[model samples]
Target chain A: MDFQLTDEQRALQETARKYAREVIRPKAAYYDETAQFPLDLIEKGFELGLLNLAVPAEYGGLGLSHLDGVIATEELAWGCAGVATSMIANDLALLPILIGGTDEQKRRFVTPFTKELKFASFGLTEPGAGSDVAGMSTTLRREGDHYVLNGQKQFITNGEHASQYTVFATTDRSKRHKGITCVVIEGRPKGMTVGKHENKMGQRASNTVTLTFEDVRVPVENRIGEEGEGFRIAMETLDNSRPLTAIVATGIARAAMEHAIDYAKQRQQFGRPIAEFQGIQFMLADMGMQIQAARLLTYQSAWMLDQGQKNTLVSSYAKSFAADMAMKVTTDAVQVFGGYGYMKEYPVEKLMRDAKLIQIYEGTSQVQRIVIARELLR
Target chain B: MKILVTAKRVEDPESKIKVKPDGTGIVQEGLKYKINPFDEIAVEEGLRLVAKHGGEVVVVSIGGKEVHEQLRHALAMGAHKAVWVNHTGPLDQMGVAGLLQKVVEKEKPDLVILGKQSIDDDQNQVGQYLAEWLGWGQATFASKAESFDSENEKNKVPALVVGADNKTVRVVREVDGGLATVECQLPAVVTTDLRLNQPRYASLPGIMKAKSKPIEELIPAGLGVDVTPKLTVTKMSAPPARKAGIKVPDVATLVEKLKTEAKVI
Candidate 1:
């Protein structure tokens, strides 16, 4: 099989990489330190069409392929995973509507985002449920021409900033996954409260908070699908998103490895560059090898989705491998820098911090392992 | 005004360059290529001119198939179309000017903008040569009225003021010490300096749109231009590495060394 990206794909990658280097990398540390949402860069990203890659062309969005999305995401992540997460969160938010909403719903909900710079968040995780989707305590009740939504979605990305939210809540908790319903809530309703931004360990540039929706009214027209279909919709969205997550991890790993290489070549020990030592070289080699493998796997999974192939198993493989790889690579990159890596003065420490979340979010490494084993057994 | 802009593929200035062991040329392997930075400025100027005045910016590049990358890059940055002069051999500035003269005869653009010099060669002759060859008025080293205001530069506000008559344009030229303003008539050639404008990045949508834009290919033979080089480099070599400097104990000693050993005084 040929590995060459199409000319258009190459162009996409180049554009994203250039934007990442020129606009995002310089401010990454500042955002990380202050834990501020990068609104200015997000506006620039909107102008550059980096924010909404997967939305359809009919709705005034790029309608880029899954492969194109991941390709661009990798470069954006290389700049800073936190800022990249903030940018890609829009894709995550809109995927549910794209996958399950009607054409009319897409026209009403997705088209406005294309015309201006705006934020939207995917609301799935709750205070009670992290990996267990079916066990979430968020509730949705049928009302006259509207659904009453009451939920506390914690660790929600773009929670405080988003003007729109695609939230998942159950209509009947006893029915487990079958009871879930997906609804699009635009703007804050009467009783909804956005909590303070979480002081996260990594990826702090992405705004994460607890969303408390008390009797938030969602229009009936905003319901994504049948009551029982939210589980399937969320799963499909994650399947589409997992490859992108994997590539983001790959980007972080790549950046860390680059920093390690540059540091190793210049750093001296025993009157010679540390790079001359086999210990450092092998670490670098391992980092390089794993990064390449992760990148290839990520590309393959994303390509499969674009080709309309079922890629759940492969997505899990890529996500788990790339996440674990990033955590290890960034940690080793810190080791390469010795004591300098531990300080805020150096970049590797931030990268090491950033790599930790990739292993834990979008289904933790353990959850991904479970999926892989389940898929294999099936 | 219809504008013709040149985009020359050159080694990226940031790439670590090494002269080949044979001393014939640089090591091409693993070297990154980009559109000449000055040429990129020229393209930006053309686009800005067209943006306000309402016309097309046609970008042209001369090289082998690889130069298509440069052409596409210009297109991605919002050039209307491209003309590729497909030839893969040595050509001096004279040959390049001669070839462009042929393309100019065909396209008949009102203005032709080029980089003052390609970074790789620094042979700032092609624009002047083409202007003389075409018997057109020329403006070289085009800059802004003052030190660039970053906001205006980022917004790509045109530095060159086109006369209300539409047949003349006023340009700020960067002379040896200061700026000189000149007004040239229509069908003129202008070369861009660094301060002309800050070139815009090719947005993702622009890149995708560029993929569908047409690129017409021509050859030197097809244009009836003989590309025999009048200027040839006999050999290539890297500059000598800079030596470490010795710190003097006192200002008097530093002054003495500057006057005698360093020979600055």
Candidate 2:
């Protein structure tokens, strides 16, 4: 029932806050402008232990609580959503192995993550299938002690540089969801190719591309859990990952609200500070209210995950509410900035752009609503 | 070389401090405590010395049990051990310095470092008093510090390398209008300025390890030092509000205002 963070959690939060203020917040626009991956910043984050949030202690990870991880993500996201996305993408790739992989598989794939600032990806979502996990056509055929994978994954985050991937492929398409299996693979093997890199509207610092695995031979031991369980694994991974994304969403909303608040107080019009006008004051108030609400939902969901509770419904609620609120708040922030918010020189517009992705990734807003509805009906 | 450093817990520099309604103390409802910035510099300097020379850094703090947070922070910054002396403060500069001198006698470290001043009290006298009590050469307000031939046995501090050639540490301090460089032999005291080094962030691994590192707690009474306070605070108050700026049309008016209204001619 206590809402207070432990001293360690506070320390971790303070570290991320200082880092965001010193490193990420100032460089966000430049990284966005140049549309370059922040490799050095990523290294700095690893050094600060901001990365590897999900790894186990035996693997040299902090083994941070879900709420602690969320607190960190929120601070880092406040600095720059694009930069936060790039960092969290690594954890997104690691969660699957943690959830379903064998100890050997974890030791083999997950442990090395702490050793360096390397990227890994959760390989899901094909060109033809985004929300429909069963609609994937990637296939895996059994070979001697290996599974030969043949398929393509579109909008794969960190595709170009990820050293390993927890991939999804079907052993039998006719079995639908049951046909799916989780396979962990590594490197640019002979038959694997990294396809086109995407140029996106926001979160441009986060890399995304299409990866094609043609006759890529992965060892059988790399398979996570039993056969016919990939669908459940992916859903649970989303359940865990959605809250992290929700925290980032709430961060974007808070960042936008803060900028708007600053603007309202400083930007003079009609011979007075705009904040003096109820019209602008009310907007700022509403933005603050939404940011607070989103933060509560996001933090509650993260705490639930930490408590080992079933969180599909709440996770969806958090992701959708936070994303929608961020979009609204950031747009209102632009309004507070008047014409300047529309320009690249101002930070609110970039914040607005970054806010758009939260509703899109982890699950689109529409998909989240449907999941929430089904959970309610059940 | 074995180095000892002092860490002090103070209110975060950015936090607002206001007098209590009673005027006897500060408002404590929302104050965040952090290691004094200058102490962080002292810890960083000791850590750097240990990194270059084979040695251990021990951090000591004087306060209530809560001061362990600052001590753990020093350990997380890579100090090898910590000692906590449990005591509440009303101790003036001399009493606190006497306590530290007792610790130095027990630890017998080759080098002792302290922040030149604490942000909370701004009392810049503890290190000076400690050096006087110990009869050791003291270098205060050091902005930069380096050890010579640290890797070679010939220049190793006698504490760790007895019978070796004399080892020394060179330090530059900010003196009135300029910087002063001084070199001290082994078993000396050094006080750090803000420019000594930028303290590193405690990595997550470091934080976890610090949780397990031991802190040996002691009581001031057991040490048998007179820790009675010599000063009492009768009141606390916030700084005065800033006066709003005024513009004059010409230099004549500006000069007249400076000479008359402002009384600053």
Candidate 3:
């Protein structure tokens, strides 16, 4: 029932907050403008132990708890959601291996990332299948000691730059979800090609592209689990990851609220500050309340996951609520600034743009609703 | 070169501070706290010194339990250990210096570094008082070659350089319109100025490592130091609010007001 963060968690939060304020926030607008992958900032974050947070201590990683990871994520997102997204994509990429990989597999694949500043992308979504997991057309075929992968994964974050990929494909498409399998592919093979970066609507600092694997030979040793297990593996990874996503949204909402509060108190109209008006005050109050509620839900879901509890329902609740709340709060922040908030010169409009993908990615708000309802019925 | 550095928990300058209704102190309700900025620099200097000279840095703070936050911050910045002087209630500059002297007598570090002034009170007296009371050589307002570039600060080249003999330290002090250099014998005290070094943010691993670092607690009474405030405040008050300025219609009116109404001319 206690709500206080442990002293170590508080120290970790402070460190992340300081790093975000001093390093990431200053360069956010620049990266967003050029849409360049912030390699330097990412390296700095890696050096600071801000990346690869969930990797086990045995592998030279921080081995931080889910609660600790979310606390750091929120502060980093408060600095810049786009940069934060790029940072956390590594954890998303590693979750599959962590959940299903053997000790040998973890040592071979995950340990290398801890020693260097390299990226590994989560390969799931395809051009044909966004929300429908079973609709993916990526196919895997066995060949003696290896598997041949043929697929096109679209909207793959860190795809162009990753040295490794944890990809999901089906051995038998007719069997749908039950037939899906996951494998780890190291580096680009002869038949594989990385597509040009996508000009995304928001979180543009994060590199997103298409990956085409044509007869890509992956070693059998790299397979995460038994055949027909990837659908659950991917779902579990999401369950473990959704709380982090929800906290990122909370961070964005918190950032937007702070900007709006500062602007409201200073913006003058009708011979006084706009903050003096009831309309603006009410908007701020609602924003503040919703941010707190979303944060509480997010922490609870993350805490439950850390405690080895089934959090499918609560994770969805947190993800959907926080994502929707971020979208609303950032938009309201823009509205609070009136015409000025729409301009590129101001920061709020960028936050408003950056918050859109949260509601749509990971699990869309609609998808989250479906999960919540199904869990309740079950 | 075993070094002792001070970390004083102070009100974050970013937090909006209000004097209490009774004028006893600031309103504590929504206030945030952080290690004093100058003290953070002093800790950084101690770390840099130990890194090159092959020794350890021990950070110490005097306050109630909450001061552990600042002590932990210093530890996370790479201090080897901490000594928390457990006490509460008000303490003036003399009281702080007396307590630190006792801790110094016990720890017996070869060197001590402190912030030139706490941001809250700007007393700027603790280092000097401790040095005088201890009968040790003192160097104050330590600075370095004037540069704010990140490159210069990346390696954290210390301003307080230890001599080749290992018994004396050279300090660059910021003085009026120029920098002065002085050499002090071992077991001396140094206070840090702003340009000593840019403090580093604690890395995640450093924060985790700090959790296991030991913090030994000692009460003022246990140290046989009397922490009675010799300097007492009669009252506290905020500065008067600024009045709005009237706009003059023209240069002639402005000149007339300056000459007559304001009577400055």
TM-score winner? 3
For residues A327-355, write the lDDT of model 3, one tens digit per residue.
Answer: 99999999999999999888998898889
Candidate 2 fraction of reference contacts recovered: 0.62
* Per-residue lDDT of model 2, residues B1-265, tens digit only: 7889999998999988878988888887889999989988888888877776778999999999889889988888789999998999677888889889999999999889899999998989999999989999888998633333235523433221111343666777877877777777778888888766678997777877888898999788888899988877788777788989988999999999999998998
The C-alpha lDDT values of all candidates are: 0.93, 0.87, 0.93
Worst 10 residues of 3 chain B by lDDT: B150-159
Candidate scoring better on lDDT of 2 and 3: 3
**What TM-score would every model get versus the actual structure?**
0.97, 0.93, 0.97
Error of 3 at B26 (Å): 1.1
Query: Candidate 2 clashing pairs?
Result: none
Shift of residue A113 alpha carbon in model 3, Å: 1.9
Worst 10 residues of 1 chain A by lDDT: A6-15
Task: Rank candidates by DockQ, best first.
Answer: 3, 1, 2
Using Cα atoms, each model's DockQ against the true complex is 0.77, 0.61, 0.81
Worst 10 residues of 1 chain B by lDDT: B145-154
Please list, in the order the candidates appear, how each scores on TM-score for chain B only: 0.95, 0.88, 0.92
Query: For model 2, how does the per-residue alpha-carbon lDDT over A113-169 read when each residue is reduced to its tens digit?
Result: 898888998888999888887999999999989999999998888888899988899
Per-residue lDDT of model 1, residues A107-223, tens digit only:
988889999988999999998899999998899999999999997998989988999999999999999999999999999888799999999999989999999989988888999
Worst lDDT 10-window in candidate 3 chain A = A54-63
